[model samples]
Target chain A: MGAIQGFEIRRSSASLRGSATQLRTLPVVAKYIDTSTCIGCKACEVACQEWNDLPVSQTEQVGTYQTMPSLQASYWNLIQFREVDYQGGVAWLMRKDQCMHCADPGCLAACPAPGAIVQYQNGIVDVDPEKCIGCGLCEPGCPFDVPRYSERTNKMAKCTLCVDRVEVGLEPACVKACPTGCLQFGDKDTLLAYGKHRVTALKEGGFAEAAVYDPPGVGGTSVITVLRHGDHPEWYGLPKDPTVPVAVSLWKRILHPLGFIAMGAALFGTLGHFMTVGPKKPKDTSTTSGGEV
Target chain B: MSDASVPASAHPAAPGPSIMRLAVHREDVAVGDEIVRHRLLSRVIHWVVALFFMVALLTGMPIYSPVFGWMATLFGGLSVCRWLHAWSGIAFSVASAVMVLHWLSDMKLVPHDLKFNLVQYMQFSAAEDPEIGKYNPGQKLFFWTIPLVTLMVLLSGIPLWWPTKFGSTLRQVCIIVHDVGFIMWFVAIVGHVYLGTAAEPGTFRSMTRGTVTKAWARLHHPKWFRDVTGDRKE
Candidate 1:
């Protein structure tokens, strides 16, 4: 019933090239996740559900402390728990799972519906429920496997980076509910620097593999994570190096334009043939007349 | 084969089971000098294939690119087009399969047809061969291409319909395959339509009216005209 105010779009799905103009020039924002200080608390998950007005999904324990194996359509934010063999003993490694809001989002590239997926100038990616046709192209488009298709609504759902809250000068609900200062939100550059700083402190304290996980493969993610076992990202259920699928890139960038050209050529070719050659008719018309049975 | 002396009402309706067949299946054999090129069943099958193909194309173009997004409104919306495209594609595939089987015997490429130069034919540089039978090499090529492209689209579309069941790698491959199949099908259909209608004046009547004039048969298919009409004159 209300118009969406604020947030200038930088990129939009299935739009013409150079159409999404960023007129407002908003500062790029990001969520900084320091996995070292996380206590495996599910506050962020609860906050995300409450803020988004999503119904709770019944999750069963599968011989682990995790609430679920992965994030669901209704459950956007998740705290992934992994008991890893760390420093000669087992330690609980916690990582917040959600959409990374990539600088070069694959979901936006693969989406065929106009205005379904959009990226704001503030570096927040949001899905317009009204515009989404639920073709499920975004599922294979995502490098992180983030987008979830809801059978009830026939639409794809994922973390929107709290675009509504960020527009109103408020941090995301997950960051607000995080008791441990592990979750923080601020300017993208500041968080990148702070995440790197934590990596240095963790390395000095004895973890040699402590590094910032801001992969440049997807033009670096909006959510920057500082992991002690950054060298082995798989331990925390994260891809070490993630990029948009080659098929999505090839289809959107090359095949789409080529298909139009090919169709045009076929049409024009037929017209040209018709004009030059004309219709094939009988040389003599006297014997052409006949009665059908 | 009735002559002008026989009254139209004196003849019984063409042999078929249904009432609609009475309209399609005309009086026994060609009257006067008209040659029966296609029967009522073949014409109906051909139209069914065309109907589903157009439905699939109209519904699919919108999803293929945003440039044709306005076409989605004809069916309902993009969401409706999504499922409609798949269902129509299935219908198209089924109709195409029937068409393929119905025309397979006539569409076989003989060794002599190998010399049928496509470029020369399109440019009107070469004349239609007198030895050509029911179908020319070009027509046979288009006929065979239908089933091949239809199979490609159908196989790829199955995975796309249930995308969550397959891996990302497979779905990505299917996307490219589906688009490639679409382009091939579109281009072929364009040429087929042109040749069937405008390019050849009397050809369209064969599919619609189930007959062509003796002169039309002689001009396009000389050998077939001789076989049907017993006219051996040059």
Candidate 2:
């Protein structure tokens, strides 16, 4: 009986081994933004909706021209209208909100579903509708909360950085729709240089806090920002100093696989040991009974 | 019952029996001589996790940027790598979820597991720690975190893929959550891989072969060894 069981265990283990030897590679693309020339028209928002064919949101007068309340499953991009006190006059802060398409995107790392969320060769975050189960796990992992889950479709949706357009060598709809040359798309190097020059020109024109917004945090965003004020990134609804959660790192690096291995070994070991060894031999009792005659 | 009446030493001293019957260690629990452990299904499920996880990590790096874009060369080119990375990520998540369901019963934190502060297991002195069992407290902690991290990655990745559809505020939030979660996951998986493949010498074999030597069981799991071997005395 023990031999048969042992052979069976070995046979099963051999058959179960799988080849998980595939290596992954990524693309080289840049997501650039030129905030110097933004007119705060929110044309990018309109363009994004029209091009993507998204439903229009019934936004009320929220005291600001910034209409859409927040990032939702349907609205991918929004131009935030902030009324900032600059020196003496109230300067209208019109910042376009969308995926920064970080050089090191957190969404890609956090996503478990392959193709559900991906980065293109041009460095844009893209999603696969078919693979998404709308588990809503990636929502909390994002430092920027870029991905939104649609209850209707039961899948998360967000910006694709116009990967389709970029693939065909065309500018994104939002960039093209901008009447004021505010949103610019190009290679990362050129965009960085342009952003720096723009910042210099803005600061020279007496906009003191006109600094670039792409800190080394979040592995540096492809979409660079030149804010009108510098009080806080959070004041503009951005995290002050974003860092990946410790729990995620712990799980990715150690807990998940190790746990699986340990559990597998333990379960198998216990079962195997039990089946082969059977029950412990009954304690010796003949001597105590004095059965010898 | 009749066999129980015989003196243990006398039975082994029978003249016909060899003085030293080389003890055959059963692969499963030995009933005289027997062994059993993981069947094929369990081991296959385990390796599925190991394989997809690596693929997910490799493909994911290039998507993160040029710094790791060189990684793309491994998969063919940047374009192919793009779709591959996302798909592999999904595969890893699904496989891991299956693993979670398979091991949920055993991984539940029992009272005995709670007695030992898990932090202590990370220390160098843990090798000698008596409380350590077939699965240490640290291992249990790592097991539980897998589902949590997988869930985070999946949810945050959605808006990133189709940002135009999600609201602006939510997109912003997803960015933050996704980045933060990735860093944490990167660090944790590194440590986990180290422990499973390198930290323990005999462990990888258990996952691969689905069998451990009797000696290994005795050294690592004394109570289990005793119960299996039915040895009550020295």
**DockQ of every candidate:** 0.71, 0.03
> Tens digit of lDDT per residue, candidate 1, span A45-144?
9999999999979996866778988888899998988898877999789899999999999999999999898887777888998999888899889999
Worst-scoring 10-residue span by lDDT in model 2 chain B: B17-26
lDDT of 2 at B59: 73
Q: Tally clashing residue pairs in candidate 2.
A: 104
Q: Using Cα atoms with residue i matched to residue i, what is each candidate's TM-score against the true structure? A: 0.91, 0.51
For model 1, the superposed segments whose C-alpha errors exceed 4 Å read A1-3, A17-21, A85-88, A286-293, B1-23, B26-30
lDDT tens per residue, model 2, A187-281:
77777777778877888897777677775767777677776555467656667766544444454455545544654565564445445432221
The iRMS of model 2 comes to 13.8
Q: Evaluate candidate 2 by giving its C-alpha RMSD to the native, one decimal.
A: 15.4
Error of 2 at A176 (Å): 0.3
Model 2, B83-174: lDDT tens per residue?
67567778888999999998776567767777766445433233434433455567778888888888898787667556345654465566
